[model samples]
Target: MDEPRGDYWYNLVTGKVEVGAQSDWTQLIGPYASREEAEHAIEKVHERNRSWEQGEED
Candidate 1:
């Protein structure tokens, strides 16, 4: 059997995952092993973006 690859979450803006190889920042999103994990990460990105936007309004 093939070894299972672990899931990873990539930042949309920074293009860096919590765990993974470095790559072109702009082109990085995810190599997640499952869709749920990817969705979770995306939620985080959205939360951060919202916070930043709010901060900018201040």
Candidate 2:
């Protein structure tokens, strides 16, 4: 069974890692599976964008 837990979020404005929503939805990045992953959310997004631009995801 799935258990409920507080999700992680990256606040774009303050560049903070939150255990749950503390800011407006438009200013956050995620509900990442883990805190560590959420902490690197921006880097992850940038990496994915780079891969896509280079067709590395193909």
Candidate 3:
């Protein structure tokens, strides 16, 4: 059987990584696969936005 992957969230209001859905939906960024990914959620979003503005596709 495959191991279960945990859900991680990035709190937009507090700018912190959470283990799960512990905050209000409006303030959380996502269900990232890992803590490290959750920590960089904002950075990833900004990067993607910039790419879109430059006519680039990921």
Candidate 4:
């Protein structure tokens, strides 16, 4: 039998997405096709990370 590709998850600790058969310190939110895709998602989140912080203090 062939090994499955399995599900990929985003690694918040490493700040990079990885695919494998392991989950613990890593967060398995969902799967992404490529690292670029995952990075883009992270970037989007970061873009908004400071929005609330800045708004409240302003």
For every candidate, C-alpha RMSD to the true structure in Å: 5.7, 4.8, 4.8, 4.5
Better of 1 and 4 by lDDT: 1
Encode model 3's per-residue lDDT on 1-58: one tens digit a residue.
Answer: 6423568899999999888789999999989988888889999999999989888543
Candidate 1: give the clashing pairs. none
> Number of clashing residue pairs in every model?
0, 0, 0, 0
**Candidate numbers, best TM-score first, in rank order:** 3, 2, 4, 1
User: Residues 2-56, candidate 2, lDDT per residue (tens digit)?
Assistant: 4235498999999888888889999999987777878899999899999888896
lDDT for each residue of candidate 4 in 1-58, tens digit (9 for 90 to 100): 6323434557766666666625674455456655556556666667788787889898
**Candidate 1 segments whose C-alpha is farther than 4 A from its true place:** 1-7, 10-27, 30-39
lDDT of 1 at 53: 100
In candidate 3, position 44 carries an lDDT of: 96
Report the C-alpha displacement of residue 38, candidate 4, in angstroms. Answer: 0.9
| Residue-by-residue lDDT tens digits, candidate 1, 1-58 | 6424564657676644545535664655777775457547777778999999999999
The residue pairs found clashing in candidate 4 are none
How accurate locally is residue 42 in candidate 4, as Cα lDDT from 0 to 100?
66
Candidate closest to the true structure, highest lDDT:
3
Clashing pairs in 3: none
